[model samples]
Target: MNETQSILLASACFALAFILASLLEYWLHRLMHVSKKVGARHLEHHRNNTGQGVLWEFRDYIRGAIVLIAAMFFYSWVAGIGWLLGSLAYAAFSAYAHQLQHENPTKCFWMKMPVHYVHHKYGMWHHNFGLAVDWWDKVFGTYKLVDWLTEEELSQPEKNLLQLRWW
Candidate 1:
């Protein structure tokens, strides 16, 4: 392939990897809800309403996908690098979003409603499984809009957007 074609292919791979990561996240979260063993672990998060820190979360994501990332390199070096960057970017963003929602759901500005926050706060077992974004939830017909911020949240002291566990 020409240099231009290689670049375009890499770019396409990046975008595809980014989107695939989100879709995978949505499905994995849903799996956790349905699988008893997984749900047992996930229940701890619901009970605590806390995140395991951004870096740790990202590490977990990378750890889980390491083999897939390696397989991407076999396709092509450019594609592999692009996919790696895109997947890492999404993992980082999702980790940050997860932690932010746990610390202060109001700080999540990208979404009109932070789905994960409501999922946990409302004990929704069958809805709002998307962790990074709500696109998949909407696509799968699992998205539900509820009054997220109650009087309790409204009355609580405001928190700084960056005041989250980042370790």
Candidate 2:
């Protein structure tokens, strides 16, 4: 393939990997609601309404995705690098999103509504499973729109969007 075609192929791989990561996140979260073993661990987050810090969350995501990343590398170096970068970017974004929603849902302006925030705030078992983005929830027909901000939240002092636990 020409250099231009190689670059395009890598770019496509990157986009595909990013999308697949989001889909995996959505499904894994959904699974936590139904599978006893998975739910057992996930229950702690619901009970606490807190997230394991962003770095830890990122690490967990990378740990889970390492095998796929390795497989991609074995297939093609260019595609693998693109996939790896995309996966890492998604992991970082998702980790931050999860922690931010837990710490200050109001700050998550990327989404029309922070789905994970609503999921925990309302104790929902079957809706709003998307963490990084709400696209999957909408596509899967699991998105539920509601007035999520509470009186307490409204009354609280405003916080900086970046004021989240990173470690």
Best prediction by TM-score? 2
Candidate 1 similarity to native, TM-score? 0.94
lDDT of 2 by residue, 43-149 (tens): 88889999999999999999988998677888788889889888998999999999999988888899989999999888989999999899999999999999877
Q: List the global CA lDDT of all models.
A: 0.89, 0.91
Q: Summarize candidate 1's per-residue lDDT along 18-76 as a digit string, tens digits.
A: 89999999999999989988778788888888999999989988898888777789989
Q: Cα deviation in Å at residue 53, candidate 2? A: 0.8
TM for every model, in the order presented, reads: 0.94, 0.96
Top candidate (lDDT):
2
